[model samples]
Target: MEPSPLGSVDKALLTLDALGRAGADGTSLAALSTEVGANKSTLHRTLAALRHRGYAEQSADGTYRLGPAVLGLASAFLAEENLPALLRPALDALSAEVDELVHLGVLAGQEVVYLEKVEPRRAVRVWSAVGRRRPAATTALGRALLAAGPLSAGPLSAGPDGGTPETEAALAAYTAPGTTTDRLRAAVDEARRTGVATETEENEPGIACAAVAVLRAGRPLAAVSITAPVERMTGPARDARISALRELLPTVLPAGLAVPPAP
Candidate 1:
């Protein structure tokens, strides 16, 4: 017999993927042959090999489905994950230490996606669970990362506007009872002034958040945040959050990434 153009292992893998999309009622060999653009004989032999390996199963009615071996691959990947996972252990320990909720988010368009979170053991805590999405303009982490975009002159600076149309629009979104758009603009100004951002009841009432940007190659890759009940997040406590981050920020940075602005 002439050799099959579809290699044994490659052909089996392709057939497995096709069966998943085809679903349980099953599909015909001819249909799979057409879908994979392989001749009938080659495709049949591939499916037989898959059945023997237990990576793909055939139904009583002759349909195909994925097998249990895939779980081993998925489990292995999840075991040694990083960043969101690597940061979680540290964030969790911090949450217990601070009695607050901690989060790590990455900028996504005009919003930020909550990628990792650590919550307090106590019942009373700030909301916004892991995987919760929040608008960038009105949140502390968003403004922190945004403000890291520009440098500041002082605490409450000269102009409320940052000379950019985008900055002004972002500044206009802080309208949550205690927080005004002007204040948010000022807060961003202050973060640029002080190198971090903090907010109280800006997005959610009776909640407070402090965020510091993680810079990479002159860009903010993501932000780290700490959230707590408004009362617990005030005075010296809030100030400490900012102070500690500034001190420790250099440690997390890589060799070339730790450059401070030269006078």
Candidate 2:
């Protein structure tokens, strides 16, 4: 019972993606046609339509690139999405108390999409940004989100690997001291049990974080985390951060976004 794909729309989006990858210099029609696998004429028509809508712009040299219209669309989307605005004040407050970076992220398939980032005054250079994505298994935010439920209907109706050799290789590739599949499984289980997730230098070396989901009726809508240098996150200080997150969740989350009582 699969639905039919919208071929033309797909092609148009692929063309835009190609242009984005091409960077500021833009791409010529010949290159775009080759990348999108379309005839030059059809691609021309598509590009013309996009240009008319202000989604694409042509440079003087006959190359095309993404236009300011894309920014407009993105702005509209973010405003309508509202998650960032909704969480900002709470995240800001949390960052102030902890004197560390606080980020809010949502689960997107196998990754977590960062929506907002609040950096303390003495923040480290974080590798993430607003709209960036990272693997769910490799972060406390991802583990916390997964603790609520899967993004789609599948296994773990009740909930959501550490490593074999294959997994070890994959984990090694992810980062040094990266998460193994088995370790990831263990983290998910722990989050389910405790309603919090923690990680040390998994994504970026020297960074550690503790996170918890903001749930809506037992499903995770998003997650929030406090991140700091590994040395700063330890003993009573780390415990205090976890305690603060648990205490703030009820007050920070709006009415509709309720965290179901722990089982």
Per-candidate TM-score against the hidden true structure: 0.55, 0.58
**Over the stretch 1-263, how does candidate 2's per-residue lDDT look in tens digits?**
45329878988999999988998899999999999999999999999999999999999999999977887865564442688887788888888877888999987777788889998989575666888888888888988887676522223223224335553443333332356556765676677777888888877888899898887656677889988888878988887787778876567666656543544
Full-model lDDT for every candidate: 0.66, 0.77
Using TM-score as the measure, which candidate wins?
Answer: 2
Regions of model 2 farther than 4 Å from truth: 1-80, 151-178, 259-263
Off by over 4 Å in 1: 1-82, 150-181, 248-263
How would you encode candidate 1's per-residue C-alpha lDDT over 103-178 as one tens digit per residue? 8876666666788887678765456665777777667787777666532222334354444655454455433444
Question: Candidate 2 has which clashing residue pairs, if any?
Answer: 161-181, 161-182, 162-181, 162-182, 162-183, 163-182
Query: Which candidate achieves the best lDDT against the true structure?
Result: 2
